[model samples]
Target: MKEPYEKPLIKKVQVGLSNKFGSVYGRHLRPEIDGVPISDLVSRFGSPLFVFSERRLREKYRQIYQMFSTRYPNVQFSWSYKTNYLDAICAILHQEGETAEVVSEFEYEKARRLGVPGSEIIFNGPYKPLSALKTAVQEGAIINIDHFDEIYDLEEIAEELGQPIKVGIRLNMDTGISPQWTRFGFNLESGQALDAAKRLVSGGKLILNGLHCHLGTFLLEPRAYAKAIEKMVDFAYELEDNFDLKIEYLDIGGGFPSRNRLKGIYLSPEVAVPPLEDFAEAICDTLLSKLKPNDFPKLILETGRAIVDEAGFLITTVHASKRLPDGTRSYVVDAGVNILFTAFWYNFKIELEEDISGPAEPCVIYGPLCMNIDVVAENVQLPPLPRGTRLIFSPVGAYNVTQWMQFIRYRPAVVLVGEDGQVDVIREAENLNDVVDRERLPERLILKKS
Candidate 1:
């Protein structure tokens, strides 16, 4: 067999570059996932399928839990439901002794459905409506008040229930993060957090038992956590001195990053992202040093991406190839931003299904969406592979499933690959009925044909 011919062009070659497709060839050409062939998955589940490694998911949860548990005396991990709240994913973490961390009433109900007791749930996020607050208060869920309004709502709920409700106030501080996430919680530097604490104490209906703060997401610096912990601990001591509030816990909210490299990050994830060990050391060292030997509060981590990102993969097929007016090669794939929503931020690791031996060129990978922003990757090096060639995109297990939208095309099916090489469909692919199930046709608009 002869190789496909190409219109050759002159270009400068980079030093030490290999015949591989991309500079990230180390992660290129994944023909299989967890001993299951990509073709087999696509054939059974169809293209643009989402595959998860149950083994990797369990391993990540254990690894992070162990890292922090060994360093801190009482460390609790709360699985962030907003990350990937699929029952399958959540069940896996819950089975690993993780408590549920929900941001809304819907998530709270999901956790409860999974048999997570209300007392075991950590409720975070802004905009908890009256109904949500009422349910949370009655269920004994650990509620973190995000604003003064939520504080007021909870107090009313506590009074209505005729009981003392324990609550935590979310704080935002200048952890040296620019464009800081000051939107969610009370500000510590401006004394907003202290003021909120006073409100909780004076109100008498709510008890301030915990202190919570989430600096930002995709955090690369472990020292940032150390600083946040220091502030939170200091605030706890202040509460104890002035309001006699012995803070029961410190909820260091999750922002730990996955191995996926950010868009503007100059260094690779291996060098740019600090290891979990560094984070555990930074947080635990600060906690142990500040509190007394027996007075250390429960340290809770709400990590999401770091634990599940690497465990997910998306299998897409090349639908068509085109040469742009600028002579750049591009491909139209089945998966798009609608399902791979993180594509807007993360440039996932792209690999071919099989080895395509040819001169590689820089090309663009586009999704099936008609929108201009439906690009999967740009200027990625790849060989000129024909249509129907499957490509694997990975580390997409974090937010895609939760944040994905049902747009012009149907969302694909999701499968979980077990440790013994068995496969199970966790989510079925969407169909016309699934899309139009809730839609209703007006009586006047109904058409009758002969």
Candidate 2:
């Protein structure tokens, strides 16, 4: 009896405003990135691999640089290290002439180890220990004072070192943007930022050269930047008038959105996110109008996410697929929130390597972690992706690697595909020894069991 096998089928009731067609498998879709097949990458590097494209990184950097440089004559980009501190990524930015913007002493040391001069590094964030501040001040790094205490700390350090240091004051302003980030810097509206400047000038311990402000992360509206630029210009003028100080540079700080769609967002990122030109235009237009040609200060931009997010791809394999008791489909994959931390906030777009055609059903992707919160995608419409199927998650080049937690499994290797299609392992996969190497064992606790 030679009977043909038939696939098992299940029906799902569509919910509110569902895309019934699911992912359209069309002729234009090919699962090759940078001319290399996804299957080949998986087979060679192993599943749950992180692939970064050098071409994409360079292209994005150049695009952003051109966009801002064409408008502002003295535009400088400082790569924010906390976003993605992989040495390879930082090296690329350094090679492309980007200074490093580090928030911690560890990150500051990392930049120095990478041969980034102290003068080129922008040391930010609160909680810079006295030791770190002394090193930064002595090494000539641009330290942006976060609060009054930091100003006092720098004053003490300047006194101890017997050398006056140049510094910038991080300002917090009301730009009419929702959910303002007031925790980082001095408040501008309340005149606290001006007071900080006055203190610095009166102390004769630090040289105030720059004004820094980071509005927020993942900013989508360009108008917010416009308003912030206007306020910054006005504030700089006021500081110059009050303290008789010339602002050397204005650090707008990074908040540019990538192409990853937020979890609660209905529309895809491509449609929702504004182009890079919009942000540049908003900032450049405001600066050009406010400052005279003779008074143009060097513009510093700390662009982290927008420069590298689209260049990263995560390749994971589907380990198991099953139907829940409630008639909903579920997929278990090797990658989880432990590794792909951005999954908690972003609904990352997943693509299948092979052609999948059938009645697409809504499925929830679960990571291999045992925790209840280890979900990757809440609800994505996809066709039947059985066991051993490979799926690629895109635009994950930002915070995932830097903030990934090492809980259950070892972190995987990260490979960078060169412009010539040559793949190199930039970060090797961690082993059990790598995880436990830093542990200390007590002799009294080391006993042999019978």
What overall lDDT goes with each candidate model?
0.89, 0.89
TM-score of 2: 0.95
Which 10-residue span in candidate 2 carries the lowest summed lDDT? Answer: 20-29
True-structure RMSD for candidate 1: 2.4
Give residue 396's error in model 1 in angstroms: 0.4
User: What lDDT does model 1 reach?
Assistant: 0.89
Per-residue CA lDDT of candidate 2, range 1-450, in tens? 664454565665454343633333221234888989988888888889999999999999999999999998889999999999999999999999899999999999999998999999999998899999999998999999999999889999989988888999998888888899999999999989888888899999999989999999999999999988899998888888878889989999999999888876767687888998999999999999999668889899999999999999999999988778777789999999999999988988788887776656678999999999989986677777768988888889999899998889889989999999999999988898998899988999998999
| Residue 198 Cα positional deviation in candidate 2, in Å, after optimal superposition | 1.3
Using Cα atoms with residue i matched to residue i, what is each candidate's TM-score against the true structure? 0.96, 0.95
Per model, how many backbone clashes are there?
Answer: 0, 0
Report residue 79 deviation for candidate 2 (angstroms): 0.2
